[model samples]
Target: MNTSKNRRLVILMYPRVREMDVASVNDIFATANTILPENRRYQIACLSTVDAPQLDGMYGMGLRTGPLYSTFRGEIDTLIVPGGMGNELTEPPEKLLKWMRKQGSSARRVGSICTGAWLLAQAGLLDGRRATTHWNQAHLLARDFPKVTVDPDPIWVKDGNIYTSAGATSGIDLSLALLEEDHGRAVALEVARQLVVFLCRPGNQAQFSVALKEQKTENTPLADLQIWMQEHLAEDLSVPSLAQKAAMSERNFQRVFTREIGTPPSQYVERIRIEAVRRKLERSTQSMEEIASACGYGSADVMGRSFSRQLSITPGEYRSRFRSSGIMAEV
Candidate 1:
């Protein structure tokens, strides 16, 4: 089989950087290297903006990073900027932003992991383009750089040769996509299996999970009801049923639930059911009818509409894209 040409992957690191963001991208490419011939492997480097030989990272870890000056003029196939806690406290050095713009212009592709998108925006590299970062920090990115369109929903966003991924693990998904582009799906799948991650999440996948979003409800009754809803998905979850369970009138329950949860009770129940259906599809051999019934849908068709409404993809399509080899083995 023919493989693509070797590519140079450069990671730009800084003090207080999230170690996972840097490591995830590096590991994906490194794992791919173990499966590829020398001529087609990625050339990886971790460089720091500071002149120091060692840099402090988040969670009390120290990283050994090469000074950026050493490779300022070298050819770069792909340049990656990783997000850091420092992004919240201080701006990156002017020198680094200058270098980033230069590298971003020349490299075949440039990308960011998490808040690393901040640096790209600061460098004016993301001006007038769509991008995403860790969802928690997504608002700040958009507020600080109004010129850049920020979409917080996706695991990643790619515009032309620039890529930006949400959070740290999304970096893994981004790297796998890049690997698949350079090599093939088979090579990427092998690396994913070795790493024990989903093969590769699509760029448009939601950044946050349904469970995480549901946990944000502060109202005690609503919070308890959210948990109950998950456990009783197959049961009736209409406002009247939920209201009766909460011991409140249906009118009052609807008002309070919408105010506290930011979504109506019915919508929240649908989200929970869809999440359940998604997991079943990814990990089990259960037929669509079984999954739909278990997850509280009236039927497969009812479940399919809800899944497509939120995910823009149908249940069967989601299963085909995400059902891994391990799960297929069980069948």
Candidate 2:
């Protein structure tokens, strides 16, 4: 019975839960725990709405929970809720909202994912502050609670003591952000690397994955072509050039690519280029001009404008704001 709780992170799990929501939170905490100084580790627990449940995940897998309240409530540090079927977003359970309101009053910090934002909003905790949720539910949140400003962009949002994230595993991104806020960028970055997470994705980053939208089907000819395109980012990419690479007529390639990916090939290439640029911004000290050239853009202006268009910030600004604290530095 050696319950060594170096850090406390409690998540409220619900039925029909997107497995990724739970897995993402668990993965980040697990990775962060491993990196903790031997004596300093995290303790994560799952609690159900009714205190516990004999249940299954969103995709129908078995699961469990613990007590209704934390044993270390006086020392409890962070409280989180995972998104699934029910929510405090539109119509909230008076009891659930009351309990959540109580937790928000007592805990050092409060957080939620996707529809979980709905719960917080219903609890009267999110009024007059900016927050976000899954895109499918973002509009609903705004419509229900006119007082809360809903930004349907960033993968996550922080409003003073309240935190909410986009759909599903964006919870990981939110957790990583909190890790950085609690420990430091270095620890969070390490956690992300260990989990093979792309980066400590900032709250200002896009909610949806452009690369995911454009990814080709597995084992298909187009899939192989897309992989090849990703590999050769620096090469001249034109309709004729890429069509030749795909072994198709330029006109046919353009039509087929648009149909499959929902965007023109050139736009997809730009999305990949921006992803590369964003990664460089986080991990390197390269100047905007250097990043643009390395990522296949012509100049700093191109990179800066592109970032502003997609991310609402200049490349230099994004790097300064998001990368100021060196990776592995103070959280």
The number of the candidate with the highest TM-score is 2
Backbone atom clashes (below 3 Å) for every candidate: 1, 5
**TM-score of each model, in listed order:** 0.78, 0.81
Model 1, span 1-331: residue lDDT tens? 2355788889988888899988898899999999999999998988878778888898769999885654556788899988788684477678778888988889989999998898899999999999999998889899999999999998888898899999988888888878877887678778889998854566766787686776787788888888888888899888888999999999999998888888888888888888888778776789999999999988999999989999899999988877641222211
Residues 1-331 of candidate 2: C-alpha lDDT, one tens digit per residue? 1234476778877767667788888888888877787666777877776555566777887777666643324455688878877564236458777778888888778998988887788888899889999988888889989999999887888888899899986888788878877677767878877877755567776776667656755537778878777777677777889899888999999998888877898888888888778777876777877878887778889778887897787887777776643242212
Model 1 spans with C-alpha error above 4 angstroms? 70-73, 217-265, 275-294, 304-331
The residue pairs in collision within model 1 are 83-116
Question: Candidate 1: TM-score?
Answer: 0.78
Stretches off by above 4 angstroms in model 2 are 1-7, 34-39, 51-53, 70-75, 88-92, 216-223, 299-313, 324-331
